[model samples]
Target: MSKYDPLSGHLRRQREDELELTFAEIERILGAMLPKGAARQQWWANTTDPHTSHVQRKSWRGAGYDAFLIAGKERVRFKRVR
Candidate 1:
């Protein structure tokens, strides 16, 4: 599977209302450790606008998903917008 497949698979299995996932859950799904800043708000920013170096995470957008921080970085919600 590709590095992004885990997240893509999870999104594929999601119900219409089943959005949002914890950062830990995402890390587990990826089967690997995330970057130190993975839990930071800037890590998941909509970078399609201004370019950013955190391009690896753009995988979520490639799969039609977007993330929003909740509970001050305790968790993140992966919402499918497309």
Candidate 2:
């Protein structure tokens, strides 16, 4: 069996299943919410503290801020906060 086959049984037993998004749907949302080209690119490239969602670029201090919104796996919708 394939490597993925072993995980299939476990994955199937999960309380929640993966959600699929169509390319068109993703494009539409990004088009409306994301800032133009360069800004959007910069945002995704930056990684911050996953817990506080604070950016730590250039310093280890907890002063940096999140530049984008994201939804946790258990979250039903994306919440924008800065």
Q: How does each model score on lDDT?
A: 0.71, 0.30
Candidate 1: segments with Cα more than 4 A from true spot: 49-53
Model 1 TM-score? 0.71
Deviation (Å) of 7 in candidate 2: 25
> What is the alpha-carbon RMSD of candidate 1 to the true structure?
2.8
Per-residue lDDT of candidate 1, residues 29-63 (tens digit)? 98977777766777777667536555555677766
Which candidate has the top score in lDDT? 1
TM-score of each predicted structure versus truth: 0.71, 0.21
Model 2 scores a C-alpha lDDT of 0.30
The alpha-carbon RMSD values of the candidates against the true structure, listed in the order shown, are: 2.8, 16.1
